[model samples]
Target: MATKFALLLLALSPLVFANTASADTTNVLFLAGGRSHASGEHEFNAGCRLLAKALNEQSGLDIQATVINGWPEDQSVFKDVDAVVIYSDGTKVIQHGWERADQLAKSGVGLMFMHYAVHPSAEQGERYFRPWIGGAMETGWSVNPHWVADLKALPDHPISNGVTDLVRAYDEFYYNMRFQEDRDQVLDLVTAVPTRERLKRVINLWNQHGVNGIGKRQTLMWGIQREDGGRGVGFTGGHYHRNWAIDDYRKLVLNAIVWVAGADVPQDGVPSETVTEDALNENLDTYPKENPRIPLPNVEEFMQLPPATNVSMEDYENAKAAQKNRARKAKAKQLAK
Candidate 1:
């Protein structure tokens, strides 16, 4: 696959000869909080810019990352973009911006949100943003000192292939989030166990701000999924200034871009079930663009989900009974053959 990709890039190189060349472009919009007014807060603007650059180079995707300094969220910001990553954690995304963000998330455009950006409404100086990326910020699990992140149950996931474990350089571990209702939607949960120093730090924060801030003290470093009828991912880590350039983090972010772009599917992926033409036509007036590919929130969790069956229960049962009779008849006829 790598060789084929290289050969394909070489094959396409001639297009670059023209200044007006239009490449096979995938546009990515990244929003990052420039800096925080809080004294201890880290400035993540430069880091976000670096992330966009790294993703662009590695994935061959065109990226536009801007530090949304007092920028109002507008629909046009995401218009025609293939995906959007919200990395701003300090400010609460205004109501209008959040509504629009939700619209985009549901419309099949890919979304990626990170760390403090998840906690938009925390009473602290940090503002919590809305839960558009399919997860919510609740509290911390453990305040482990920046420790190693262990990834389990994701051996074959594309984004997790080369990433077995990673240690955060220097950043507060964020844990305890109110995840969305569907657990099946979670692609992978990378846990950052608290170290002795992390526990001590959590204690200090609790003593200073009371017990509300720290609990079991775990934070989400990264995650993936395509759920609620849309494709998206949420990675809450990348707090330390230097972790952004680390090889694993770099690949993780790059893989995330490709996955969210709806270009990369998990191995041996199944196509969505087809809806009947007549029923679809009837509903087209209400949901004009709705297609079989779109998923819905009430769909069963992937693990617990039975195979997709759109036909009525009676019709399904009758079909199964007929199938059994047909099998029996075929077996009886096989003796004659």
Candidate 2:
């Protein structure tokens, strides 16, 4: 009877250990910047919330995601997180905490930056950003142009798991990044050729460098695995907040978040429910009265728009003047109030 009882206890030990291991959860932290761009453009806080909501409610994975506006007041928040995602203007959030962030990187925590967050001062770019994320948008070298990026192909990567079909969107996609010297260590996840026909406006940081690379392929999204067993990703296509309504665009980011967290991406990638116009409007930052609310695009209609072509310099100037006029009038109206 004693021998039989001992055998039963031994059999249940495996089940007990399995349950314990399965209960462990992965923690991801988001550092969102304050209001930066015009309404319906940056939306960093809202964007982070939307993404965190997806991971918490829709991802079907054991992920705990937290979003802190600007930088966290409590530095302890960084402790124990498996990954960190920054969606903000430039590198302001991590400006004062480079050492802390570097410690995280050295300890094998995953890091990712999106949109303008990928841009850092050249000094910081060389000192930290390039090594941390494999690349950074260098001023005088990189160009931010609003164009139709017809992402027709993706490399074979876990981040590309469920991302199928063409992901063409009009965004301020920055290219010509300054990457690490060891090009062999970087994985270009998404690349698209920027053609003269695909460009809509080439105003910011546009120069001889941008003009020379019009017909060449550029890396819009890239990833790297560091010697410390950490992972990093740089994405340059989150300029328009409304673009989040696109399924593939949202999924690719979701997949990256999971992959960076060291979690197993589902065979079909991290599943997320369709984003509605109502959902898109939630959690947006309050802007000045002059900045009118940009309407959320109807997913299907927006996707069906024809490929973009270069806007004539005259047309660009006219549009810029009209926008300024609207802002000036709106300012007067607010002052009257």
Candidate 3:
């Protein structure tokens, strides 16, 4: 399998492209977060731009990925894109630009969720996602821990086209998702068995409302073909943006995007250019230079989280520091008075 990723760029095409005689073009709208745990953790904006550049540069592919840095100021961007790929902090899948989900679903648009995006709260499961992505990460019912996932073998599917064995990655892989009743509509594309070392991290792994997946198989990627003729996919590995460099990892995702967009996926998956170190750092989020890395927050303390997820390390530290600064200033003013 080749190790190149497709980049998507904004094109002046109409609401939809006529793939019949025009190009085999599929316009994919990418959504990345404006903030994250660290400068390069989610790297939503940077990663989306990287994908856009790769797809735009594909030799024979005509797919374009227009990336929205954050939630669009105007929702008109969802006019008629083939697919919507979101890679950000997604605790609420129904929010964001999801207000247009009805329209998109009515038009048979494809939806792709990556990394943290796959983990929506339990309440969101039956409300919106079960019919869309087929499954979602439920709090207390799921686990997120760093593990060296060996994507050695892939299932026979368009999403796994041209993907070879022996793809290894160290990422925060969240597993044990809650799928719909007739789970046959969806299938896992990528599967990995946890190593002994990583298995220890998940002292309590839950799946299907049971304590499962510590010493067994896990689904890292899944695709859903909704009865409405639309498509939905969920990828559990995106915590580390750098993992996108792995050829098989990148190829698998590229193939899925095309497949979801209702485009013909090549036998060798969507070909992408070799991403360089310089390219990885291109459009990263801004972070405090003085504080290189922030400490990881203690989840036990926030047993009752405002959301179903933990705070990004960087954002948590920033908020903590801001509170301290405010208190210090207040004390100083009192002394002067």
Sort the predicted structures by lDDT, highest score first.
2, 3, 1
The candidate that wins on lDDT is: 2
Residue 134 in candidate 1 has what lDDT? 50
What is the per-residue lDDT of model 2 for residues 1-337, given as tens digits with 9 covering 90 to 100? 9999999989999998877765678899999988986788889999999999999999888888999998787989987799999999897888867898899999999999999999999999889988888999999998888777776436578888887776877788898999999988988888888887677667747656677778898899888989989899999988888888888888888988888878888878888888887888889888657545556655445435554333444554566678889999999999999
Task: Tell me the RMSD of model 3 versus the true structure.
Answer: 11.3
Instruction: Specify the highest-TM-score model's number.
Output: 2
lDDT by residue for model 1 (284-303), tens: 11123333331211211322
Please tell me which model should have the higher lDDT, number 1 or number 3: 3
lDDT of each: 0.48, 0.84, 0.70
Clash totals for all candidate models: 22, 0, 14
Clashing pairs in 2: none
RMSD score of candidate 1 (Å): 25.2
What's the TM-score of every candidate structure?
A: 0.57, 0.83, 0.76
Give the lDDT of residue 280 in candidate 3: 64
Candidate 1: misplaced stretches above 4 Å? 1-24, 37-41, 61-74, 94-96, 122-131, 139-153, 164-168, 197-200, 203-219, 222-228, 265-337
Candidate 3: list runs displaced more than 4 Å. 1-24, 92-94, 199-211, 290-337
